[model samples]
Target: MRLASTIRGVTYSFRSIKEVLAKANSHKSGDVLAGVAARDAVERVAARAVLADVTLEELRNNPVLPYETDEITRLVEDDLHEPSYAAIKHLTVGQFREWLLETSTTGELMRSISRGLTPEMAAATCKLMSNMDLMTVGAKAQVVVRANNTLGLPGRMSSRIQPNHPTDDVQGILISAREGLSYGCGDAVIGVNPATDTAESTRDILMALDEVTRKNRIPTQNCVLSHVTVQMAALDLGAPMGLMFQSLSGTQTGNEAFGISVSLMDEAWAKMKEMTPTKGPNVMYFETGQGSELSSDAHHGADQVTLEARCYGFARRYDPFLVNTVVGFIGPEYLEDGAQITRAALEDHFMGKLLGIPMGCDACFTYHARMGQDELECLKVLLGSAGVAFLMSLPVGDDIMLNYQSTSFHDIPSVRGLLGKRPTPEFDAWLSEMGIWDGGKPGPRFGDQTVIR
Candidate 1:
């Protein structure tokens, strides 16, 4: 059905829900690259105006992809909380936006109603929100998940120590992990992105992280960010898997491009539950971002924000321990600059939390992106204040392996102290006991990589 709105005496009409969503999104280079972005600011505002009047039921009825043709659509519809949906399904998107911003809307209420929200509704809600609006309302939803450690607690923040190695060398990776631990950054998980994606390489990396964390008695988990199939192969070889990791896409077609199926992920999650060494209901770690679907030619005329939201919807099914958007890693073609990156980071966090996903951010930019290091630093403070679940912590804000910039180990202390947040309960105690952190301050061995060993 066509949707139309008048602005400044001009009526702009959108042919479909997809067009409305794509045009209404904050200016993302990827949308423009995809030739789906609005031609001008007036059309963009008109699209938002039309979208605000779109009822939740209308969004539900029109999945970005046809329900019969897409499993993701089916999965979203099949799993919705019926009573919660019935309560506010009649409200137009504008009313829902107002409802969220109201002071009476508590975090508990947000949590309770989250199950009723579809990814599309979550997407539409975010499009109409300003940067501060995203942060202000996003802080209301609390999503707690656990593996060897817990995350997403109120007054708490965590950091995933991404000790990536270009050569997949276990020793090089361990040194980085040890360094991160000394800085109190691995309380979330010690995750490694392997340059070599293979069973043996994954198994070796997994064993190394497992041995180090276990021997040191660190109260955290570990994961080798390899393909799910490779990790599964390593698990079959009896590698100690703390948390299984995977990259997810918003559409079935996009997931296929990643060489994954819902069934494969289901099998992987079941296998991890049956065999993972971690003690928890949450054992999966997932990474998602805007523009992944478009990158794979699977966006299906939808905007990056909506496609990104669908990833959270799919991820919630597996009960992931950690989930984040590597917001700018898709590069300048998608995010364009610091402003675009900032907009995407907030939008992703807001949509993820509203849809009941434990959300975090990489807060990064590639060298080619027009963003400077300054904006990245401000982004960390912004997300931390917004009650994000976690942020990626690298050695000096640079991922040597991935060739991008992100939050650093040094940034962890200031973020926590400035934002008045703490690490997960178990990891905080371990940090204190290990002489790495003391009473909300860095301890004597704060930057000593040798402290853990």
Candidate 2:
């Protein structure tokens, strides 16, 4: 479903996962509203109180913790207050569309979308179905969704070093929407697709992010730009198109091209780490599976998938908190069965695997078109049902869109209403058994205060 359309329909229940879990565990209403209110106070006011003590460096150092509701609340409050935190407040579909109309560029288009209640407006409403809770439940939701194997990966682009056009821009936009709008507006990594793949191009973007962050005071030392898909070192987009995955009739150079692609990826990683060091709890966004030369012939092997996994595993190993998943698969390619591989793998292999860390996805944008509105509705259910982060891609004329998801974890006290009373006794029992019940008096330091040293 196009998130932008659903922004107005967005309503937050002002509750906490911990409280809901408690209700599930005991089936009591005694503390439900109170638990939810405590979360709201922490999120709306307390968290923001601690902002002065924190710095980009400190926030990155600890980042947000799974149960650190206070910290996340502050981050959201800080973003809302800080005029420069464009990614947080203004980027919302409702706010963004309004801003677009105000900007010199895309203003006319914004006017068009603003005029009547069109499907675009409906889609925009979904964008509001987002939150700012990154730690606790939001993070847990990612784990649960990943475990459920529902989301899909949007394929990568052939051009390694593509610019921010409609196609490549869509990826980043999607990341933001998924994390920001759908799942407590948390953080996820995103990449740029340059028309060419070379160390220089990669370096240029890294440098650009650095400069932009510094210029805009966004602070770059804490973040890592992700490099997923077909990454290799020293290989420019030039170089004879090579073997062409689109038409691999026979062994051209005995699959040297494939090996080179892998090597290029290595180089890309090395360079990225060098350019954007993972200081503090920085992140690197990466994804895989670009049809590339294989568009015509789908002869992918387990090794390729393994390579992707290894890429993720490597990120996990290098800087435990620095790498976040943004797995992308183009077209109708879901996980092994109908699941999204990253989500499927996480659910099947990574559940309870990592205690504090969270896994994320690109979103549920590519569900089969034939599935129709069911897919869209299904996505909504997934968002509210599982807390899976979603990324929204804004339109670029008729062919391109921009990607948007959270850059940091956030909490939302608004989603409580979306979830009616617990569904079944079995589910409730599972909640109790899982020890996921929400309890623990709201921490004393409910406001946003971080140790910045």
Model 2 reaches what TM-score against the true structure?
A: 0.35
Give the Cα error of residue 425 in candidate 1, in Å.
1.0
lDDT of 2 by residue, 364-407 (tens): 23333122333333333344444333332222101132232211
On lDDT, the candidate that comes out on top is: 1
The weakest ten consecutive residues by lDDT in model 1 span 1-10
**What is the lDDT of every predicted structure here?**
0.92, 0.26
Deviation from native of the Cα of residue 439 in model 2, angstroms = 22
lDDT for each residue of candidate 1 in 1-453, tens digit (9 for 90 to 100): 459988878889888998998899999999999999999999999999999999999999988999898889988899999999998899999999999999999888888888899999999999899999999987888898888888999999999999998999889999999989989998888999999999999999999899998899998999999999999999999989999999999999999999999999999999999999899899998999999999999998888999999999999998888899999999998999999999999999999999888999999999999999899999999999899999989899899989999999999888999988999999999888889889888899899888877
Q: How does model 1 fare in lDDT?
A: 0.92
Error of 2 at 410 (Å): 16
